[model samples]
Target: MTITKKQITFSQAINDAIQTAMAIDKSVICYGLGVTDPNGIFGSTIGLEEKFGSQRVFDIPASENAVTGVAIGAALDGVRPVVVHQRSDFSLLTLDQMINNAAKWRYMFNGIHSVPITNRLIVGRGWGQGPTHSQNLQALFSHIPGLKVIMPSTTYDVKGLLLSSVFDDDPVIFLEHRWLYNQVGLVPEGDYRIPIGKAKIINKGEDITVVGMSYMTIEALNLIAVLSENKISCELIDLRSIKPIDSKCIIDSVKKTGNLLVLDTACKFGSVASEIITLVVEECFSYLKQSPRRITLPDFPVPTSPALTSNFYPQDLKIMEVISEMLSKKINHQKQERPPISMHDIPGDWFKGPF
Candidate 1:
């Protein structure tokens, strides 16, 4: 599938995608905070109310849990509902509705009920929003058993993933990075859908496999360019869908590259990164040449100051540094583990973590 190069901002691409879906499917309804009212905060859903009418695109009360529960109920009754949470941090309010109700309804109902609901969340860091507003909670949703978690970094993925999410029978948590909304990219002119539970290989390389999602995917792309300039070829995998992850792609990439680096914006501990790393090690341990390293935000709460936040959040430079160190260690290990290599010959730190 070839995508034409046409410039468009991320937010505009998302809006166009939703509008296109609504035009074709009357059951597709969008509702959330400031989405249908006087101020559509990001303008992603602006003018949608006019075209779709108030019934399809309307605003709800300032209750995240209630709004999500309403969407879940509608979805059960055959309505493809898209519930938007203005901020990712606010999704905490709907945990019960999401995890217990929406996620388990189908199993609890013996497959008679399906939750075809899409919960759109905006994740942002820095910009002086403080700890509360700047949290990246994709990992939290990804941990749930029945939810499909998607965090697209590019405008193309945003449109394709959202379109796919609308059609999926299971509940989907679509995370949009607030920082990438204005960033421009070329998207196909017509309706399209990128398959859910698929990973895209952004760059081909032989050295290390870097798995990233959401805005961190873009950061990984940038680091890949820099690493290439230094003669370090890195295979980049965009985990577009966090849940029902494309483990085959990751395993294959690690088998070829012999090293892995899982990068994420979520906290370092108990994050999606840990899950990815676990999968790679468990499935492709023999293929790995060195320990898998993860570049992620510190476990502490997000700081308010720009300088402090920058240090707390995982960035391109930090990723590059970690990758370089891993590569160096791999080279040294290969030299030591020659001919009759034993388990002890392999680096001890490589097996420290479970994954």
Candidate 2:
């Protein structure tokens, strides 16, 4: 097992994934708004058009529905099209094409056709982008049966998952959190494909498990470090794919720790966290020592003000506070489960306060 290192931003990792996939498969094509040439927004697709040439990597007009329709048609005709929407909110404009067309094509055609297309969406709540641009709509596409929804939190996962998405037979909605573009992580030097439905446990611990996706995974890791300094250990699970969720990983962790906490940038209701909690309760209720808790953005549209936006979204501090409370409760419950022992059985100064 050899390790190779390269310093690349999150956005560059995505660009690498697209480039590698296209190099591997000639059928793979990239297109969408700002994905081409001079001054591409945020530069995620920078240099792609030049390297792949206009025929393979071209730009589309400001019509998401039309672009999506074209991608789906291409997929049906045996071409793998990777379409990008400027923002996650823009995906709403193509709901008809996605929900009715891309999602139902194989089923409607009785397996005679497959939509091997990837729709890349940039999502986040920042820079006063406000209500229109800050929405995290991965949950919406995850609801559709035939669509695969992937939200990678790290550069490695982004690279591997994006490669896998381009080759998958079903249509995929890849939601890239805009705010994570600059965050750095180590990625393998060569091409690799991470299994679509598997989850990765970034940290291991016995006390509790924190499950998150995209930027929320970064927040979970940050909270884990903070809690460790306080002598509390936590496991972090990154659910890279939302649609085909890794329930086995989630349930196994909950069983081992007997406690669960989900951190999601999306709203609390009808979100990925809600579905995960429901799955854990249904599958591992006997193993759970306490009820699962979730830290999520408030169930409302994001605000424009920076101060208000910070308050609206979930943060590391909020995650740390919730974990502390859960740990305290767990300690109390353990005390009740065990029998009391004599003073001689206890450690010295056990009853002393901060001594």
Residue-level lDDT tens digits of model 2 in 103-179: 99999989999989999998855657788887898778898899999999998789889999999999999999876
Worst 10 residues of 2 by lDDT: 346-355
Off-target runs (Cα >4 Å) in candidate 1 are 1-5, 37-39, 329-355
Candidate 2 overall Cα lDDT vs. reference? 0.83
What TM-score would every model get versus the actual structure? 0.90, 0.90
lDDT, model 1, position 8? 88
lDDT of 1 by residue, 215-320 (tens): 8888777666567667888999999999889999999999999999998888888899999999988998999998899988888887766556546666666687
| Model 1 lowest lDDT segment of ten | 346-355
Give the Cα lDDT of each candidate. Answer: 0.83, 0.83
